[model samples]
Target: MEWNAPGEWTPAAAAEPGQPRKGILLIHGLGDSPWTFVDIAAELSKRGYLVRTILLPGHGTRPEDVMYVTADDWRQVVRQQADAMRRDVDTLYLGGFSTGANLALEYAYDHADVAGLVLFSPGFKSLSLDWLAPALAVT
Candidate 1:
């Protein structure tokens, strides 16, 4: 679990004492670990963003841990982490990969204060073969 553990990155101090800080909370997808965001977190940190990555409930541990996890479990973790991050930064962003992206979307829907979202490979729904009609027509 060493490599899969959650991590955080802090940006350099603000130029002015009263300047507001910007932060992002990244959630890893199902069957994935926080390591998925290591590179991106480093890049964002370099760009003056306070970045954090969380180990989703039932993740970063035994594979059996996910058996009892539910969507509500993940949602609660996201809500708690977001609230905590908001306390330290003036602007907050949520980012996610795969299933995590779906969770982020749901959170943003009810929380208007979220500054923005960065989603990658969102897992909103299963891909439909029906959408292939246009691509088949081109060929």
Candidate 2:
């Protein structure tokens, strides 16, 4: 399945012919797009797993879009994708990078029965204004 969105990167699903589809959801990091997982997805596809990558609402596109998206919105997208994959695959795996990894963890926490999870460079903290309150107010 191909998902079109506003960005330089788009969601893609790749699977080998004749192989039973196995779902692997790849979530890109903050400000990043699904393009980050092209190589990873290709490698997994060669191994016969059905791999899918998604562009988070505010990522892989105009910066303005990011302003309009919230963490919950991203979560909704992941849920929708996982639901779609579950319909066809016997096993489902979730993976992500940075903030995307954080989202993946939240999803896994909610769906512990998932087949597996892969997180790359998970974001524990953000160096943005959202994180500055404590830093500046500490003094």
lDDT of each: 0.90, 0.75
Q: What TM-score fits each model?
A: 0.86, 0.76
lDDT of 2 at 124: 71
**In candidate 2, what residue range of length 10 has the lowest lDDT sum?**
1-10
Across residues 15-97, which tens digit of lDDT does each residue of candidate 2 receive?
A: 34555556788888888778778778777766667777877787655666777778899999999988877776778888898
Best by lDDT: 1
Least lDDT summed over 10 consecutive residues: which range in candidate 1? 130-139
| Residue-wise C-alpha lDDT for candidate 1, range 1-139, written one tens digit per residue | 7568889998776455876799999999999999999999999988888999998888878887886788899999999999999998999999999988999999999999999999999967776885875677522
Give the best candidate by TM-score. Answer: 1
Clashes, model 1: 0
